[model samples]
Target chain A: MDAKITARQVYKRYPSVDGGEITALEDFSLDVADGEFVCIVGPSGCGKSTFLRILAGLDTASAGSVTITPGADPRKPLNNVVFQEYAIFPWKTVLDNVAFGLEMRGVGKAEREATAREWIERVGLTKFAGYYPHQISGGMKQRVSIARALANDPEVLLMDEPLGALDAQTRKVLQQEFMRIWEETRKTVVYITHSIDEAVLLGDRVILMTAHPGRTKAVFAVDIPRPRSVESTALPAFSDLTYRIWQELEGEVVRAMGEEGQIKIEE
Target chain B: MTRNTLLIALTLIAWNLLFFIAGWWQPLWWLGLGVGFALFIWLADEAGKTAPLRYQRTYEVGLAVAFPVLLLLAWELIARNEILNPRWFPPPTRIAAALWDLTIHYDTFNKTSMFGRPWLFPQTLAAEGWPAAWSLFTESHVLTTLWRVFAGFIIGVIPGIFVGMIMGMNRTVRTMLDGVMSAIYVLPKIAIFPIMMLVFANPFGEGPKIAVVAISAFFLVAINTMAGVRDIDPVYIQAGRNYGANRLQLFRHVILPGALPVIFAGLRLALGTALIVIVAIEFVRARKGVGFVTFYYWEVLVTEKMYAGLFVVMALGVLLTFSLQWLERRIMPWR
Candidate 1:
C-alpha cells in the first residue's frame, strides 16, 4: 500500500487564442502504489498526456505540486516513458536506440551493448537490431520503444498511449506481452490509453476522467486476475467494467463534441 | 500533305498580305525561311510516325544539328555573292579564315617586343607572352585572387558556424545577433571594400584582397548557421534533455547533428559570395589571380585574352561548386 508517486491537488491550465485560458486538469490528484499497474482513460484532449508530462517533470502543474515518494534512489529513480508516436531516434539502429539511456548513465560500451542485445532478443527484435526506426513498422517501433524504457529498469514506467497507432492484431499481441513483462518485472506503471479493453487487460486499476477542465470522475479496481487475455472482454466482469467506465466517459465525449461546435462557430 | 499544305497555305497568305501592305520583298524572304523550316519539321514529324520512337528521336537530333549548319552555309554563300555586305555582315567562310589566322599565325594580333614588354594584345588562342598555364606555377595575380577567395571563405565559414550555432542554441543569443546580422546582410558589400582596405591597409600587399574575400564570406555562413539552428526540431533537444543530457551533451548529441544539413547550406552560399567578392577585389587592384588577368587584358582592349581569363574564372566556379557538393554528399551520406 506504499505509494510510489504522489500528486496532490494538481491543476494545469493552458492559454488559448484571444486571451482566454483553457483549463486542462483541475484539482487532479492520484497515487500510484509500488508494483501496481494503473490506466488513466479520458475523452480525447482530456489532459491525460498533460498529467503524465507533469509527473515526468517536463511540465509543472499550474496550481499544485507532484512529488515522487521518498524520492528515487540516485542510482535508479522511478520514471521512464514510452511515448505514443514511438519517439525512437530515426538515425539510430534498434540496438543503439535501446542503449541510449544506458549510454547516458555512463554505462560501459560492452555492458550497454549486452543489455541492449538481451532486451532486443526479449522483444523478438533480434533480427532487426541493426535497423533504423524508419525501416520498421509501427508495431515493431513500439516494441523498440518498450525495450528502451525497460532497459533503464525504472521503478515507475509512464506510457502515454504506447499502442495507440498499432493495428488491432498487433495491439492485442503487445497487450499480452505487456502483461507478461509486468508480471516479470513487477514495476509500478501508469499507462494512458483510450481503449477500454486495453484499460481492462493491462491495468489493475482504471481511472476514468471527465473533459472540460479534466478531472477524475471515478476509479475502478479491476477484479480480473493475473495473465489477463484480450478474449476476457467477452466475460461478464470485463464488459461490466468497460460499461461502467463508459457511463462516466460518454457525457464528456458529448461535451467535447459541443466544444468543437462552439469552436467552429467562433472561427 | 493535308497538314503541310494547310500550314503552307496559311503562311503564304500571311506573307502575301505583308508584301501587299509593306510593298517589300522582305516578307517573301521571311516566308521562304518559314517554309524551309516548316518542311523539315513536317518531314521529321511524318518520319517519327513510321519509325520507332528512339530511332525517330535520333533522326530528329540529326535534323536539328544539320538544319543549323545548312542555314549557316546558305547565309555564307549568299553573303559571298554580295547578297549581303562583306564589311558588316561578313561571310561565315571569311570569319572562319579570320579565326584561323588569329589562332595559328600569332603575329597577326599580338607581337612581343625584343624586350619582355607586352607590345601587342594577344589573340585568344595565341601562345604568346606567358602561357596561361604559367599562372598556375608563379605567384601570378590570378593565384592571389584565388588564394584570397579561399582564405576569405575559410575565415568566414569557420566563425559563421560557431556564432550561428551559439545564437541558434539560445534565445538570448539569437535576439542579440539577429539585428546585427540583418543590418550587415542588407548593406552593399562592394561599397564597403574601400573602407575595409583603408582601415586594414594592404599591409601584406595582398591584405585587402584577402580581407574583402573573408568579409564577404562571413555574413553568409553566420546567417545560415543561425537559421539552421533556429529551425532545428525542439523534440531533439527535449529528447536529449529527458535523458539527462547537459548543455554540451545536448549540443554534441542533438543540436550539431540536426543542424549539419543546414550548416552545409550556409557554406555553399558563403562560397559563392567569396568568389564574387574576390573577383570584384581583383578588379579594383590586385597583384595576382585570374581577376587581375581579366582586368589587365580588358584595360588594353585585349577582348579575347579577357575572355580566356573569364573562362578560367568560370572553370574555377564550376570546380568549387562540384567540390563543395561532393563534400556535402560525403559528410551527409543519408541526405
Candidate 2:
C-alpha cells in the first residue's frame, strides 16, 4: 500500500510555565496508507491533538519530520482540519463557512458558492445555508466543519475529536453520517478520539499511543467488512476487537491518570 | 414586609448611621437620598407582595418613562409652592415654552439660529441655488456643532481602526506604543485644547475645537479596536492558516470580520465622546455651536432658554444614537 502520510522520529517539546522543558511527543512515527481511515486513540494529554496539529501544518515538529503526499493538482490543499471546537466562523453563514476553504484557495465566488451549496445539501443543512454558526446546533456546526474540509478537496483530511463535543445520541447519529460519507468519498483520514467503539466502528486501523511522551504503542486492524452502517457496531467481531484494544489501553490510561493526579497534588 | 425586605431597609439605615458616626462623606442630601431609596424599595416590595399587579405583559417601559414624568410633576409642585427659587430653577412648562420660543425665533446678535430656518430653505433655494442650503446649514448653532462632531468622528475613526489593527496584529508595534497610547488616553482631551490652539493657525477658531474632539475620539477608537482584534478567537486564526490562507487573505477573511463587531462598539463610544468634546470645546471657545448658544443663555441669566439649550443637546443625542443604531443594523445584518 502506498503511504499517503509518513512521519519519522517526530519529537515535540514545550517550555513549562516554570521554565522547565517538557516532552510532549518522543520518537512518535506512523505511516497511513492511501485512502486509509486511521483513528488515533490514547489517554487524555497523550499528544494526539498535538500530532494532528503538526500534520495539518498549524504547528511544526520540534525535531524530526512529517509529510503528506502531494496531489497531482497543484491547487489542491495538502490537508484540512475539522477541529474539535467546530471552529466555524460565527460571522459567516453556513454556506459561506463551508465555502471558506475554497475562497482561501482563490476560487471564484460563483464556483465556490456552488460547491459549498452542494456540500451543504449533502450534509442535510440546505435549510441552514444562510444561518450563522451561532444560530445552529452543535451537531449542525460540526456538519458545517466537515463540509468545509471536504469542500476544500484536500489531499489529507485531519480531524481532532470532531464529534467529541456532541451529546451521545447526536454523536451516534453523526457517526452513521460519517460512515456513509467516508464510504462515498474514501478520502485519506487521520482522526483522533477518546471513544474505542468509535475508533473500531469507523477506522480501518486503530492506532494507540502510550501515556505521556506519547509514541505509537499499538495498531489494530479493523477486520470488519465495509459498506458498514450503525448496525455494524452490533456485530460480535466489533465487540471482540474493541475489547482487545481496551485491554492494551487500560494500563496507559491508568498511568496517564496517575500523572494528572501528581501534577494537581504538586500544585 | 418580609424579613429580607425588612433587613435591607435596616441595612440601608445602618449604612447611613455608619457614615454619620464616622463623620465622613455623609451630608444631609446623601442621608435624604439614601432614606428615599430605602423607602422606595420597601414600598415597592410591599406593593409587589400585597397588591401583586399581574398582567398579560410587563410594565417595564411604562415604569421607565413614569419616573421622569413623576420627577417633572414633583418639580412643578415644588416650584409653584415656592419651596425653591423659581427664576433660576424654572418650571418644566416654562422650559418647554422657552424651547418653543428658541425654535421659532432667530437671534440676530449671534448671527445664528437654532436650525438655520428650514422653513425658508425652499424659497431661498429657488431664488439662489444649492449653496443657499449649505450656507443656511452653516449659520445654525446645532448644524455647526453637528459638523464639528461629524468631521472629528470621520477623521478619528478611520485612522483609529487602521492603527489599532496594526497594533493588534504586530506585537512589537503594540508593545512599543501601548504605554504611550494609554498615557495620552488618560490625559483629558479638553485639557489639551490650549496646545491644539497653539498648533493651529487660528487659536480660537474651529480648528482647535474640532481637533480636540478628533484627538479624544481617536484614542478611544484605537484602544477599543486593538482590544477587538485581540479578542478574536485564536482557533479561527489557526483554521485560517491550516486552510492555506496567506497573511493578507487571513486578515481579510478572518481578522477583519472578527474584529468588526468590536470596532463598531468602539465607533459608538468614540462618536459619543466626540459629541461631548465638541460641545465642551464650543462652550469654551466657539461662537456659533449649540454649546455656545446653551452657555450664552446661562450668561444672560435666561434660565428657561438655558434649559431649552439642554433639551436641544438631548434631542441631538437621541437623533445621533438612533442613526447609529440604524447604521449598525445595516452594516451588521448577521448580528
Candidate 3:
C-alpha cells in the first residue's frame, strides 16, 4: 500500500519556564498507508497530540520532516483537524460552520452551502443546520466538527481526542457513528486518544507510545473482520485483543507514574 | 383587621395627626413623618412575610409603583409649602408643564422648536421638497443633538475597530500603542476641547463638537477591539489557516466574526461616550443643541426649563440606546 503520510525521526522541544529545554517527542517516526485508520494511544503527556499537530502542519517538528503525499486532485487540503474542544465557531450556524472549510477554499457560496447541507444530513444534523453551536449539545457540536473536517475533502483527518470531552454514553454512540462514517469513506485518519477501548475499536492498527519524551512503543493490528460496529466488541477475539494491548500499555503507564510520582490512582 | 394591617393603619393615622396638629410645616414634622413611614414599612414588611407565594409578585409591583409616586407627592408638597426653594428645584409637575411648553413652543425668531412641530410636517413637505421636510424634521434641538451623536459614533467606531484589529493581531503594534492608549484613554475628552477648537476652522460650527465626540468614541472602540481580537481562541485561527484561508479570508471569516461580540460591546461604550462628549461640547459652545438649551436655561435661572432640557437629554439617551440595541440584534443574530 502507498503511504499517504510519512514522518521520520520527529522531535519537539519547548523552552521550559526554568530556562531549560524540555523534550516532548524524541525520534518519533510514523508512516500511515492510504485509506488507513491509525490510532495512537499513550499515557498523559506522551506528546501524541503534539505529533498530530505537527502532521496537520499546525506546529513544526523540532527535527526531521512530516509530509502528506499530494493526491491527483490538488484542490484538496493536505489535512484537516477535529479539535478536542469541538472548536466550532459559536458565531456560525451549523450549516455555516460545516461550510467553513469550503468557503475558506474559495468555493462558491451555493456549492459550498449545498455540500455543507449534504454533510450536515450525513451527520444527522439536518434539523439543526440553522442552530448556533452554543445552542447545541456537546455531542452534536462534535458531529459538526467532524462534518466540517470531512467537508474540506482533505487527504488526511487528524483528530485529537475528539470524543474525550463527551459523557460515556455519548462517546459510545459517536464511536459507532465514527465507525460507520469511516467504513463509508475510508479516509486516512490519525486519531489520538487515552482510552484503550476507543483505540482498539476504531483503528485498523493501534500504535502505543511511552511517556516522557514520547516514542512509538508497539503497534498492534486488529485481525477482527471488516464492517465493525459497537456489537463487534462483543466478540471474544475483541476482548482478547483489547486485553493484550492493555497488558503492553500497562507497563508503560506504570513506568511513567513512577518517573513522575505525581499521578494518584483513584478507585 | 389582621395584626400587621392594624399596625400599618395606626401608623398612617399617626402620620396624618402629626401634620394636622402641627398646622405649620417644620423640620421636626419631617422627622415625625419619617418615623411614621418607617413604622408603616415595617408593618407592611411583616404583612408580606405571611402573604401567599402567589401574592408576592403583586406585592412587589405595588411597592414599586407606590414608592416612586409617594416620593413625587412629597416633592410636590414640600415645594408647594416652600420648605425648599421652588425657583431652583421646581416640582415634578412644574417640570412636566415646562416640558410640554418646550415641545409645543416654536420660536419664529430663532426658527427652532424642541421637536420641530411634527403637527406641521405635512405642510412643510408640501410647500417645500424632501430637503425642507427633512430640515423641518431635524430642526429641533433634540434632532441636532441626535445627529451629532450618531455621526460622531459612526466616525469614531469604524476606525477604532480597524486600528484595534491591527493592534490586536500584531504584538509590536499593541506594545507600541499600549502606554499611549492608556494615557489618552484616562484623560477627560472634554479637556481637549480647546485644542479641537484650534484645529477646526470654525470653532462654533459642528466640526469641533463632532471631532471631540469622535475622538472619545475612537479611543474606546480601538482599545476594546484590540482586547476582543486578542481574546479569540488560537485554535479557531489555526483551523481557518489549515483549511486554506488566505490572509483576507482568515480575517473576514475568523478574526472579524470571532471578535464581533466584544467589538459590539466596545461600540456600546463608545456610543455612550460620544453622547457625553457631544453634550459637554454643546454646553461649552453650540448655540442650538439640547445641552446648549439646558445651559442657557440655567444662565437665565429658568430652573423648570433647565430640568426639561435634562429630561430631553435622558430621552435622547434612551432613544439612541434602543436604536443601537436594535442594530446590534440585527448584526449579531446568533447572540
Q: lDDT per prediction? A: 0.76, 0.88, 0.89
Please compute DockQ, using alpha carbons, for every candidate against the native two-chain complex: 0.29, 0.69, 0.65
lDDT of 3 by residue, B1-335 (tens): 37767868787787778676877455665865577668767776876787789999998898888877777777887787777899988998999999899899986766778888888889888988689888776679888998898888888888999999999999999999999999999999999989988998988788888888899999999999999999999999998888888999889888999999999899888888888888888888887889988998999899999999998898788787888899899988889
What's the true lDDT of residue B311 in model 3?
Answer: 84
CAPRI grade of model 2: medium
Candidate 1, pairs of clashing residues: B140-B288, B141-B288, B141-B289, B142-B288, B142-B289, B142-B290, B143-B289, B152-B214
DockQ order, best first, reads 2, 3, 1
lDDT per residue, candidate 2, B12-43, as tens digits?
Answer: 67765665577543334445444656565565
| Candidate 2 residue lDDT tens string, A147-227 | 999999999999999999999999999999988999899999999999999999999999999867889899999999998
Off by over 4 Å in 1: A15-20, A69-73, A166-180, B1-145
Candidate 3 share of real interface contacts: 0.71
DockQ of 2: 0.69
> Which candidate would rank higher by TM-score, 2 or 3?
2
Top DockQ: which candidate number? 2
What DockQ does model 1 achieve? 0.29
Error of 2 at B248 (Å): 1.8
For TM-score, candidate 1 versus 2, the one ahead is 2
lDDT tens readout by residue for model 3, A73-178: 9988989999999988888999999999999888999999999999999999999999999899999999999999999889999999999999999999999998
Which of candidates 2 and 3 is the stronger one according to DockQ?
Answer: 2
